[model samples]
Target: MTLSNDTLSELPADVARPGYDRAALTPGIVHIGCGNFHRAHQAVYLDDLFNLGEGHDWALMGAGVRPGDAKMRDAVLAQDGLYSVIELDPAAKSARVIGSMVGFAEVASGNAPLIAAMSQPSVRIVSLTVTEGGYYIDPKTGTFSPTHPDIQADAANPDHPETAFGAIIAALKARRASGVPPFTVMCCDNVPHNGHVTRDAVCGLAELSDPELSAWIKTNVAFPNSMVDRITPATGPRERALAQSFGIEDAAPVTCEPFRQWVMEDNFPAGRPALEKVGVTFTDAVDRFETMKIRILNGGHAIIAYAAGLRDIEYAHEAMADDQIRAYLDKIETTEILPIVPPVPDTDLNDYKQLILSRFSNPEVADTIRRLCHDGSNRQPKFIITSISDCLAQGRDCTGLILESALWCRYCYGTSETGAEIAPNDPNWDRLVAQSKLAKERPAAWLEMSEIYGDLAENAEVVAKFTALLNDVWARGSHSVIADYLTG
Candidate 1:
């Protein structure tokens, strides 16, 4: 028994999956930000555990803290909570059904239901995929932004909160008051030491809201840092057609490049789904893994996204296909960046770099460079800065990373090399663009933002490198500059 779509009376066979009359599993984990990444990665792992019959009692309930997620709510609900995930590779394609999410609470509707969900004792773990910027932490300073409007509003009325941090604190307060056990706060975001950052955000909010509750949360709650990876791009018409061809009526279908990895610190305090049974690695130190992904994969994204966007290129695979861009990325990673990454167990950084290039060149996924380029202010510090710092500290040159950072700032100025207007995306896009406009006049002005660049602004060598690169980028164009840096 299946529902017919209004547009296509007979749905395509490929869109169908093996029908299962599975009962609603108990919601043990409430995942915030049910975006494509979570659907394709974490939820899929949980679903695998469920299918293996180990985590059948531990399901996921989705929650959203923003208005934009209403569409996701509608899509997920329309499909009876079934979604198709197509893993696109150059050599093969595989599909899976993720049935982990059972329900959703729209936070913008009211924080009440969302908070109530968190307050539930059965929900032993709350995971997050809210992206790096969603944490509202200053990337340079590595601290929660107390002055952010959402944080301010949340701070004013601790009992009634809106931000994710505030919402978590409010629910923790409820748990403290009601004698409900504190749930593990697990962060699956890409930021380094995501667990520590999450703890800071939640406790930072709680400190302002209720000092007593803050101390209690610090004592009882657990924040487990996790490293997760899957090159899932935003799904659109092609993915929809792919799902329909697979006979799956998944309205919120997810599509990813044929690569996935999950590494976590085995530190869940309350309880967690049997994810390890489904190929997730639980280790003592995820820092090495985190660095590997951020520098190689994420850093590669930054390297190409700005240049691709500047050249008015669209898809990531398209950019990766360019010999010049591909060479530039390899040089950056292998020569300047990889040297700084701490070693991981039995992993060859060079081999990892090669795999990243292969993943980027997977045309089947069609990951857009524009998507990768979004929120540069929040991304550059995480992706580029540390490599630059490491290189400088070791008396190694950071010309490539410095140029990448400069290009990111230049890209944020809203005009591509072709004069096409880059759509605004960052939280501080307008201000950043305006700053870029004044940057050529006073190239050092943007560096004055201590919150983003920190002491990197005052480092004479960094400043000189950035200034030289910015001059070359503005004068010789991105490709020429990339060639110069790579060959120089």
Candidate 2:
């Protein structure tokens, strides 16, 4: 039977449904992105809270701004905002219907309904998982791009906003006008210092239009930095079939690895869910945790994905099981990535790196190379390039990282080592192709993407080293390049 309140009782015994009273659940959070990651991570936490009967007042009210979100809204609302979260493992699997989401707003056109929904006093937290690129941040300056068309449009017409941050500003404006307290803006995206970046985006946009409103947000609103980790692949027919095996006919389901973690600073101003009651770790400082995960796990993903892509390895575990690929990842992490990460409280960095290796080698997870390698423009800046910056600052041996960058540049050339076609994977695919083509000739041409490389591209010493590797990667091939780097 389809997963819904009316059909909850009819679900198979293997599939779990909420035991708490769904009707008692109230809207306390208006999440701006309703994608699979949010379902598998934050919504799962809230679902656990509701099951405990403690966070009934903190139910999630889903919202989105992308055009594709309108379709997700229809699917979610069709099932009364109820969906199944199926955890994947090599041996066993489990499924549950999460009931923490109570409603969704119509976001097909402008975010009028979303603004109206967030304006309500019940919505005390406006959380988001709007991807790493959604924040409109300049990767070079690490500042909000006020000149972005959406920000420009929103600054011009704040009431009829077009972006999620703009909608948030409009809602805050309404709340201020109505004499309601502003909601805490929680950022659950995987960006580094996500809360600060979110603040820069919303507050920066606000300043362009209303200096007073920007001051109010700066003074009153809360943006909590968080470290969210889970390997939730995009739901597909295979997941639908898996759900059916559990006798769940959920139209919208999220599938992820059994492992999950959420570490965040305790900075919610307008009340929040009792997520700590679940597995979430609340801390006074989240910087160390975020840095550890972003560097070792996130950056390591880039290392394996790009290198694996060059080898045409299809899945994460398969690539990880490859001796050379695993060594490449460990070499980069231990020598380069780990040294740059500051000490996380009560956590051993080496052990954490091992744990990440085991997680990546989970065979049953079936995470694809394409999924990991997608969005290099965003992932490289936050995950890969940041570490390069630290290496440059600390004068560390960055040979592995330099080779990884060369692999990335080669991967962007749209072909694999064995003459396999690599389809466009980056948001700036055209630019990447043009630069890669030029770099194939000049070897220094790839650094011309200043928007991504920033001033790092102009450093003659660094460029010389990178160009040497780029030339070797092209002349000798990726495998020989890796093998020689390993031995040399």
Candidate 3:
């Protein structure tokens, strides 16, 4: 049976189905970028809330600004916004059909339908999972790019905007003009201080068109920072077949690890669902949690991904099984990254690190090395480079951190150690491959990409260490360099 409202009862008896009345639920939140992570994380939390017969008015209305979102809209709306989330674990696997999304906005040019959906008075929150790079922040300087062509075009045509931030700006303008209060702009992405980043993107774009409106949004809208975690792999034939095994055909099934977490600041002036009742952490110390996760988990991924990719390891768990790669992750986190991470509330950093390692070793999730190493240009700045910068400021050892960056440079070469072509992984793959070729002859050439390396390229100490390490990787194999680092 195809998974939909009518087929909910036809599912296997063991599979959990939403107990709430889907027809009775009303839209209160409009989530942009309805990807696997958002489905496996935020929407699942809402599903749990609805199961308890609460927050029926806070149903999610999915929205998207990108052209690709049209395909997502069609796939989701075909099932009436109902999809299955299959949670995989080492011991057991479970599936649940989430009924939190009530509708999806029609995708159109200039995001007219999306803006209209968000402009509704009922949409008290506009949450986003548009990935870390979606925000128009300069990778080098970590500031909003007001002069980006998309931003410039949006500023020129405020009523008909292109980017997600522009669409949000248009919606907020409609609300303000209609005398309705602005919705809380919540950012659920992985970036540190994500709320501040969202604010900068929204207000920065607003300032280009109208200074008065920018100030209004700055004073009124609430961009709450959040730290969300879930190991959700992109869906493929395997996931679809998993759904089929359960006698339910779902086009957009989300397969994820069983673990999930969301640490958010309680700053929603327009009110929010009582998500605390559903295991969401409403904290004043979100930054502490954000730092712990970004460095240890995300930074840990960077440490393992490139090296594993170079050696032709496919799954993340397989990389963790490799002793040298595992040791590199452990030594780097224990000595370099964790030492600088501040103490999170009621949590032990060592315990957190162990949990991250165990999660990475979840074979059922099948998280790919390619996904982990996909966007180094944007990710390294947030995940790896920031830790390096923090260690340098604190006079801590950053050799392991620098070595991680070198691994990324090597991975950009587009050839695995087994001579398998890696295909372009990053959005800037062409430029990175070009630089990698140049850096082969001159190690300093890789670091010279100031947009990625920033001032670290100019730092004599960093330059010296990076130059030496990268040269070793070229002269010796990646495995030898890693082994020497482990022993040395």
User: Who wins the lDDT comparison?
Assistant: 3
- Candidate order by lDDT, highest to lowest? 3, 2, 1
Q: Compared with the true structure, what per-residue lDDT tens digits does model 2 show for residues 1-488?
A: 78778999988888888989999888999999999999999999888888887978889999999889989999999998899998887788999999989999988566889999999999899999999989998777878899989899989998788999989999999999999999999999999899999999999999989999999999999999999999988878988988888988888988899999999888887888878899899997698999899989999999999889998999999999999999989988998889889998999999999999999998767889999999988888788888888999998878888788889999999999998999989788998888899999987787767777878778887799899999999899888888987886
Candidate 2 stretches with Cα past 4 Å from truth are none
Top model number, TM-score: 3
Return whichever of 1 and 3 wins on lDDT. Answer: 3
Which has the higher lDDT value, candidate number 2 or candidate number 3? Answer: 3
Q: Cα lDDT of all candidates, in order? A: 0.82, 0.90, 0.92
For 44-67, candidate 1 gives per-residue lDDT tens digits of 787777766676667888888888
* TM-scores, one per candidate: 0.94, 0.98, 0.99
Q: Rank the candidates by TM-score, best first.
A: 3, 2, 1
Query: Pairing residues by index, what is the TM-score of model 2?
Result: 0.98
Which sections of candidate 3 miss by over 4 Å?
none
